[model samples]
Target chain A: MTERAVCVIGTGLIGGSLMRAAEKAGRAVWGTSASEDTAAEARADGFDVTTDTDDALRRAADADALVVLAVPLPVLPEVLRRVDAVAPEVRLTDAVSVKVAVADAVARYAPRARYVGGHPMAGTSESGWSAGLAELFVDAAWVVAADDGLDLDVWRDVAELAWACGARVVPAAADEHDLAVARVSHLPHLLAAVLAAVGAGGDDALPLALAAGSFADGTRVAGTRPELVLAMCEGNRDALLGAVDDALGRLGAMRGALASTGGLTATVFAGHAGRERWAASRDPKGVKVSLKGRAPLAALRAVGRRGAVVSGWKA
Target chain B: MTERAVCVIGTGLIGGSLMRAAEKAGRAVWGTSASEDTAAEARADGFDVTTDTDDALRRAADADALVVLAVPLPVLPEVLRRVDAVAPEVRLTDAVSVKVAVADAVARYAPRARYVGGHPMAGTSESGWSAGLAELFVDAAWVVAADDGLDLDVWRDVAELAWACGARVVPAAADEHDLAVARVSHLPHLLAAVLAAVGAGGDDALPLALAAGSFADGTRVAGTRPELVLAMCEGNRDALLGAVDDALGRLGAMRGALASTGGLTATVFAGHAGRERWAASRDPKGVKVSLKGRAPLAALRAVGRRGAVVSGWKA
Candidate 1:
């Protein structure tokens, strides 16, 4: 069998990191950099880098295994057009956060794009080539959204990439993927940023100095790439907006219950149990972890005893 | 002057920790335990412990400093009654999370209690005598809320104790303190718990194993003593609710902005800067520190640079 060629478009954090790791796994890797600077950096990091997006398409066409669109949402439509003109016979896919927008774009730009929509829910506050790491996507979720009757072989290859990068592959449709992120991904960032702004609002700003790690951790996502998040929110606005409203309602009810005797009291225990379960579980890649609360770090092994499906904890 | 005798009520995480820290700081420490077992354990940990709240109050009545009502919100009234009847002359205070409730409870039950409301805003997920650590309160905030005309000496003593634990001191009205916490402290726990529950609710339930450090850090406070958190939420229900509403509204705005081209992009940057600062600033606290988006493992000089008060460098 000819060597499996994997072309990754947009060599920033996610793309660059996966390319480095893919090269290590012995895959023939090709990447397109929108700028000469990025192309130089990607080449310096030991991968074939191209400035012409079509060269990437040709290299990834008919003879290859996977073509990953790892660009931002705003540029996806243009890239999809280029891929269509060149790689119509190839197994194609994307690493965009908003699957619905990208999927729609693919339909309009390249109806037979042979592409699947996906989001690797992993990143740091850093960006650019420097943010790339061999284990960047390890143990995170790589949500794969494909239509009916898609090629099973392509799915297998993409899933392998997910597995190789230590990410768990979860299957969802475009809208389903959109909603899940609104809840788990996008909402958290918004809360953190606003609270920080509020905390920083007072005279003397001393209250902020006392804000501590809990404040930072809870608001960690707020500091994510603004352009990226803004793009995501735009692409998945209604679902994300609904989640915000739903969360607010819950927060309001939490307050109402706190005022009543039998109220917030009942909910507190449920929160405790939920947190316990959250802490006991490992990352999707199966690494042991401790959430903010201490779950008797000694008894974490008992998580499996509690019927936790921890992946690497298989005794 | 002779060493001022101080009685620390409750022999759990906060109380026991205070007692140990106080003893090390040269205060004559007397501890009140909720039960005989805890009292015995407190004694074993080298503090003077008593099972009778009234008798201990009577015996320690002549003392200068009194840490009162070593109980959650529900039992505070009774503890105040005992303190009023037995130690009426001593300067009194508490280590509760919600300040207004403690102030109100003391005012209602022990009007002459000479009480100033306090919250150390420092702790770990551990409880009991075994969890006692003299260094726990170091460099944390020892917030004091007292009437303007109240004896500065009294507030000074409490501040001294907080400082002895290596904490910085902040002053506010009891009501203001509660509102501040409701916004920064209480709301985060609820939000984290909400997120945790959402993660826990998935069909495969593998989100638990997929729960990473971020999930753990974010949800850690939710797993805090449910009764304790319930007390805080219950005590400051209105403010906490307001905070929740505000948080949700902001989160919604952020989601909307993420989905659109405009909305609080600078706020997000400021938040990230503020959070990074909080994790990096130094207030010389011995409190267990955590961060949302960053690690709190920098040198002691860099412990808490997250607030707006500290200047942020735009990245």
Candidate 2:
């Protein structure tokens, strides 16, 4: 099968990396950045990039290429408006961190577009075009939304793009993907923030000096740019709130056990078990779901729910 | 100055590492392990290791060596009892994680011992003699207790040992050290446990599949052995409880803000600032505290409070 051309909007770390990876995988790829400096940097690095959003969308529409919105949540509305104006019915997906927000924005702003939400579970704390790596998505999980009544053709295209970029596809429903990411990604960001703040404790040198591996690992994500963290976390408010409540409940029980009995056996053992479960799931057996089958979305969601990755499509 | 002979109790990761590092620094070193298997393993590796705690203490007494307690908190009192029986007045120190518990144990079991408590802030998740690294303490902070009425001579001896092991000394009171570690070390363990459990969410495969760098890093310490985590966290119950309360409060406030306004700006920014503070203090300026001064303890504590490391000491 011939690879579909990819047009990536907002050429930051994830987008820029995707453009590079997709092109390297033999797909025609071009991208745009809102920042002229970033676009010029990418261009200087021998990639086709521009700062004109409308022109990029027009090219995508003319070629019937897959249009990927890679902008942060705060800028999604404006980007969608341009997509709606130039390519209202284009094959669409995104590399945004949250799915439900992006899907909802698509529904409101670009209703006619054939959109399937996506988030590649990969990144570094660093950002901008200069930080882009063509190998960034290698061996990573790229989540593609599998809600009912979606265009299977566009869905397969998105999964193919993920595969081409060296990532395995994990198909899940939009709302389910949001909740799962809220638990695993968004909640950890908040916890890291809290841990960092508590470790700092008004900039007390003694505590920071005594901090070692655990503290460093626990707070590593807290070093991410604050605005980016706020955008994704606040964008997934409902799901994140549920995750936060769940975390707080567990913490409260842990504190009660510690204060009363001075025993963290339950908490520690449960966590050990949890970590073991994760370790066991790291190399899940591969599965395939036919996109042409009846209830394909259900099959995809089941594959994701079982922690299995779609190694390849069964046409 | 001639290096003092050192006797280490317990041959686990920290203890075994200390034995190797001290010997490399030209100090006469021998160690005892409660587990005969571990003692045999160390002995086979060409080190002076024995399972006979009484004999080791007798030798330490004969050599006027520094008796270093490197056992877990659960086994600390038993070790102290052996110390009292064989070498009640020996120059003593410890590499325990919790300072107050070990100090209290020494006070109860070996009151006449000239003890200056110490804890090297370095380790790996792995345990046992095979996991020990001679370079573990290199460029790490080793906290030595500086409470009022501590024997300055013994304190200097402990600092010298730390220096010889390639660590910089950070002098803090026993209570202060406990509190600081409670915030940085013990509390991070608990938080990691909670985060791991929440991410696992009753062994749901979806969340674990979606987990990425943040979740992995935030729960990295939860991969540690549960019993070890329970021992240190429970041993410092009072201080850990306070830190847990502080974390719970911040999480609660974050949840409130997230739920009510869907804004996490405050939490995100605070955490970013805290991470910046840690980064700024990473390469702290060097300062020296004279052991011969009238208020040397006071000077050491002040240096620690300002996050200044002891580069060297003045006689």
Q: How many residue pairs clash in each candidate?
A: 33, 0
Worst 10 residues of 2 chain A by lDDT: A201-210
Q: Show model 2 residue runs off by greater than 4 Å.
A: none
Encode model 2's per-residue lDDT on A1-315: one tens digit a residue: 548999999888999899999989999999899888998999999888998889988999999899998888889999899888988999999999888888889999999999999999999999988888999999899999999989989998999999999998998898888899898999999999999999898445889988888888899999999988988899899989889998999999998998888788989998888888878878867786788857988889889989999998665
Summarize candidate 1's per-residue lDDT along A95-173 as a digit string, tens digits.
8777778878888987876676767777777888878998888767676664554554565567667766767666555
lDDT of 1 by residue, B118-144 (tens): 788887767777787999887677676
Q: Which of the CAPRI classes, incorrect, acceptable, medium or high, describes model 1?
A: acceptable
**TM-score values for chain B across all models:** 0.82, 0.97
Best candidate, TM-score-wise? 2
TM-score of each: 0.83, 0.98
Regions of model 1 farther than 4 Å from truth: A1-3, A201-206, A255-262, A266-270, A273-315, B1-3, B62-69, B198-217, B248-315
Each candidate's DockQ score against the native complex?
0.26, 0.86
